[model samples]
Target: MKKSIYRLIKFSILPLLFICYAIYITGKNTGDFYKRFSSPQQNSLILGSSRAASMNPEIIDQIIHSKYPNAKLYNYAFTWAHSPYGPKYLESIEKKIKPDTKDGVFIVTVEPTALMVDKNKPDDPQYYTENDKSVAKTSMVATNPNLEYLLESYDFSITNEFNKKIRPEKNPMIEVSVLDNGQVHGKVIKRFSTEKRKEVNAEKMAELKNRINELKISPTRLEYLSKTIDFLKQHGKVMVVRMPVSKVPYDIENSAVADFDKIILDITESKKVPYINYNNYPNNYQWVDEVHLEPEFMDKFSAVIAKDLVH
Candidate 1:
């Protein structure tokens, strides 16, 4: 038994030693990825779920460069992000994250889910793990291949970029439908790109909407929405805008969104921030389905967001 125990320790030590060695050797990459990724620039910053990421940063940067000239842009967009996640991420990196050195403008798209969540999920601890853990090495991902293991092992919230590998394998959350010249048009399809997800999303969002309606929770979905607004109060100037959606998805979810509008009005009123509910705007025939932008509309939509709050 003593010999066996010693052998076990010896074997375990090798892997542990290797991990430490990997970190020590390639610490720069891990250190830099986290610092650079989290550090905010002086221009504008965009955050949210797919919508923010789905919108092209290239075009946004270009426009900011042209208009603001000195504006620095950073893509802090995270996939599968919700309210609590956004607020938490901002707070965690607030000091490191800056929005336009000269101007204090931040644009964050609001989704209906931002208000309500189960408040319990694997992604929760997952985000905590990634952000909480010290990532001081660059080749960390390389040595610790299987990012999924790193995620589950550390229970890191999928909210942080580290868990990106575990993102749904099907449809990417965001994509560019039209990229012409310097303008970009992006689209948000469902999570799973499989034919099954594609076929069922319309129905799925409908059913999901119904289930939530039965619960009759306020737009905060429990407390996420309220918490989010409260958290953003100190993060410079904030604009929480609800992007346009098609009639099908909008109508089904309008009641909840109406409640959301009230919450937005309340937050903006108290915080002196701007919140635009764009559902009142006419649909430009660019919505591919009920919840996404067609190729043509994204550019116009991106420009609208830029024009409205970017100053």
Candidate 2:
């Protein structure tokens, strides 16, 4: 019995421990969202959906250093489904920020989709899409491993997560890495041909049009956004930004919410913060799809934003 138990410990327990250690090491690369949860609490933060996730904090910091020398910005932005402007995201933001942060930079990215809900049940928080997601469910946001997030939020098996790092996918269209600074870096490995890119954009635009009726602007989301601005105000300066999208989806957004820009303008004006609308800016930027900027443009875009922040 003693010999059998010793063998079991050697074969089973030791291997399990090694596997767990492997998973913990590769956890950050397993998904785009894991590293965001695993990192320490941030002083400065960039808040929005995936559109804002690509903004390089390093570039922003370098440019803004002359003004706010100690600003250490982390991109806490997730996808629209997970991080739309709402109570849950605000709660997570509050938890992720350093308690004594003062004179830190806060960049809040906005778009119509972020503030939308089910048209039929716009008032019901239960029906809100993000309520059941990581932003809402994750109570501990500043742990190294963030086992709570891994257990509750991660969809794949630990084996799969481990395999992702050990045996990576070959020739992926986009390779995404989460930096220590909390930026989601996406490298486009396979660029679509111009014709193929146009085709994909059209498909995305069509999908947006089809789903437009299912969603409606939510007053709760808007109020929570204002509350988020108010909460961040105590810590530092807040800047509202609308990242540029391709004209196809841009027009769709305007049609979906006729007063989108006006609404954002009103909020910025009332809050006395800067609102930079890149949609009206020059159309020289490139996109991976209709919404997100290509990896090459991220640093350039961050530089533009940083320059604006200082001025």
Candidate 3:
């Protein structure tokens, strides 16, 4: 009996060792590889979902450095990063974000959808990414297998009645960080006609109209949104930025946007925090489309906001 027990233990040990080694390798190779490369001379904390993560952190960093020359800036944008994650990580973030300069700002993007609480959603790297080179960020595995229609699309405008799976992870890989040669790295998988706006807008309007009719926002989401507002208040003045979307208008009366507007209005009014609603804000000549702008426009917009609010 003693000899048999020893054999069992020995067999179990090898597999356990193999499992631990795999986890360590995955964590090391795929984890926030970007953060390791970026110089930590940053002072400001830039937070948000994929849209927030999508912006070139290095640009934001340069913007902060050029505008507020004395201070350094780190782009801490997390993909699919729900606001609730903010308060939880605020302290540790503060540790990484402490700059040589005294005063700094925390710029968090407001993706209205992130305000809704998703219960038990799986992880997804395709939704957005931290490190541009991380494996999940570059994986060929379909982001949402159910939505087979979107596999070849640069189309961020579609919403389906089925489960919407982003990347493999629903949350940001907070354990990993991206470094600051930070530029937004995405491939324009396709470009439509000059009349592309009309095609895109029409597709978006129809899809959202169908989905919005069946949705309801959760209370825990509301609570987190409120907490996020308060968290920003505690840190510095929380500048709630409504990041631009292709933002095709919803059916004016009973569309998906009414739900978003109601939530946005409630958060801003109740919290009384200053916000930049660039979602509906007009785009100038340099815009990539009516909603999102070119990379240079990011600096222009960031500088304008920094000047108007932070400065």
Looking at candidate 2, the ten consecutive residues that score lowest on lDDT are: 23-32
lDDT per residue for candidate 1 within 1-311, as digits (tens), equals: 99999999999998888665543332222312232222323344565555554565555556655555654445444433222243354453343344324443466677665444443333342333224332311223223233433433333332333223346336566644222111223445545556755577667677757655643323323244445445544544567778788776777666665676776677677767788878887756554545667655666777777776557
Better of 2 and 3 by TM-score: 2
Q: lDDT per residue, candidate 2, 1-311, as tens digits?
A: 99999998889987889777866765556544878887889899999999999899999999999999878889999988999988899999999999999989999999998999988774667788998898899999988777898789878776775676678788888777788898888766777899998898889878888777678998888999999999999999899999998888888888889999889898889999989899888968887777888777878899999999999
- lDDT for model 3, on a 0 to 1 scale? 0.47
- Candidate 3, residues 47-82, lDDT tens digits: the string is 665455545545544555655555444455544432
How accurate locally, in lDDT, is each candidate?
0.50, 0.87, 0.47
What TM-score does structure 2 among the candidates reach?
Answer: 0.94
Q: Tell me, what's the RMSD of every candidate?
A: 9.2, 1.7, 12.0
Error of 1 at 112 (Å): 2.4
Residue 41, candidate 3: Cα error in Å is 9.1
Among all candidates shown, the one with the greatest lDDT: 2
Cα TM-score per model: 0.56, 0.94, 0.52
